[model samples]
Target: MLATCLAQGTSGSPTVRVMSRDTQALLDTGSVVTLLRPVLAGGKAGEPMEVACVHGGTRTYDTCHVVIRTPHGVFTAQAGIVPNLPVPLLIGRDCPIFRPNKVWHVDGYDKLKPFGIAISGCIDGYSRRLMWLSSDSTNNNPAVIARYYLQCVSNCGVVPARLRTDCGTENGDMAAIQCSLREDHTDEFAGPLSHMYGTSTANQRIESWWSIFRKQRTQFWMDLFSDLRDRHYFNGTHEHKCLVWYVLLGIFQKELDEHRELWNNHTIRPVRQSLCPSGKPETMYHLPHRFGGRDCGFQVDPQVLQEFKDLLPPTNSLCGDDNLQYFANLERQSQLAPPINWPAAVDNYLTLKEMAGL
Candidate 1:
């Protein structure tokens, strides 16, 4: 039976024969050239080609054309033959098969966990200025994210040359608004091309800034939350989570705003490798010409901006209406003052949790 299954290929066929279930392929973004096993190439004759390996070594190998089939479609590309390749094939960035499809999965543990606060932000790619960093109940809502973008445009009175963001469904409204704002502009980056969507990793400007943000601010809150969980002061219950958000969201937002202000005013030292202006972010953003940079912001029409704003749904409360009202009532009955700091917030969270019998 095994011999008959292996012998089902044409005698002079140039295509490789392999069981679909047994075949393995790797999609590598770091590699510049695709690779295939010589055995999988069906004994095709090829010219010598020099190929670089991930181990920082180079080897001359024969080249061949590889055909890959997937559920979506089929792709053919030139590949260097790697005789001892662990996988049957390796598709690299040089091939058309490198297109990315992102999927989000939720685990059972994650479902039981409390939903944390969501943050939305944007930055000037040229001056490296912090545009807006805001916290909300949910950033996944398109209206909430769009509101942030629109608010930024309204305050600045201009739209950026291009609005780049990750390919998340939450960004759909913002992308539409950006393209619409630049529709009539004569600039090269206009209309539908005004918005660019790619993976979060590719958006280095904001991605790198998040590291600084976590170290300086969010880390403390994360530690505090972990401490709460460990101490049995806060479980991942819905009511407990809502209480936490109600008590701490305002304080968190206040601290975030303060940090944003300080970051914009702080002087950044010159780096030889960086092309961005090195002075205060606020100055670089406002007066780009002084730093040999151009302000690529496009003027936004007030009427059009308002029209887009009107289409957005009203922002919902972080905790639902019943929870918000119940928590508010509990605070009123207990005569507890609103928390103004982390310590006070923690106290309020515990006190409310006990009152709600959670």
Candidate 2:
């Protein structure tokens, strides 16, 4: 058997040519029950056909059209027709994927306006699905991010094989959770390569999803009610602080929930030169194991979680004047007041009185 390296133009890709078509095939990565082409579709009888195949140049192939035969049922399938030689079935960074509890991306955005709504999000790197999205008075709390991580694993029935974060201090809480998963712990997150620490630019998948929510109503909604350009809304008028606050919070939560639905179902944008069929993240997330994809058997440790909960910062701290709400009485706006520490107020009053000798 002989082979020759076909030289490509400066802008063209190089190619390899074999002396004959009856060469032995080998797949070293894993066992191969059967040698098969990936592009053949089922529901049709197998047939040998010659088709024009163009890559660097046009050629013809006497390839057979047959579906993949797996021990199980036809596991999955995909086919595409391209105008030119299929887009270089290649591109920028390949989409990061791993079975659940294998990989996750963690980041928070603080782009909310004067009201300062902040949120933290986590995405399954493999499935490209949003694992967790949580908003609170603050996004900088390590404990809060950790709680969201715990909640995601608890509800989703999976843990990350690896975790990715933008190196923000708040994400450090994950380290404690990792530490809690000691040598004696189960295999839920036993992998040592648990976190992929990267920058905002490097963590593209989760960051791009943030734009989905931001585009919906980051500045647009806040500007609608708050005196965005005028004096500070917190001090300008009482209405700015209370009137539309709960309304803002209420509506945004609903929008975020709806946005998550739209996002989970949206077609994943293909990476630069990928030829794989675009898919919904939700499908990969929920049905991974059904189609030969692996699943990380992640189980949340209750005692470990309870121990971590004690280390988190208090989430009930009042950060702004507009932290208003409506509970049993939906029209209880009148009862809402900026969190006022009366002790500090009394001390300031007494000091002022002494200074004025009144």
In candidate 2 the C-alpha lDDT for residue 218 amounts to: 61
The reply for model 2, stretches above 4 Å from the true place, is 1-97, 182-192, 217-219, 222-227, 230-247, 269-277, 310-313, 320-358
- Model 2 lDDT-worst window of ten: 1-10
TM-score of each: 0.69, 0.56
Candidate 1 similarity to native, TM-score? 0.69
**Predicted candidate 1, C-alpha RMSD:** 12.9
TM-score, cand. 2 vs. native: 0.56
Best-matching candidate per TM-score: 1
- Which sections of candidate 1 miss by over 4 Å? 1-115
Candidate 1 whole-model C-alpha lDDT, 0 to 1: 0.64
257-356 in candidate 2: lDDT tens per residue?
Answer: 6767777798876532222224787987777765346665455667666676777766652334333432213223233332234333233323332332
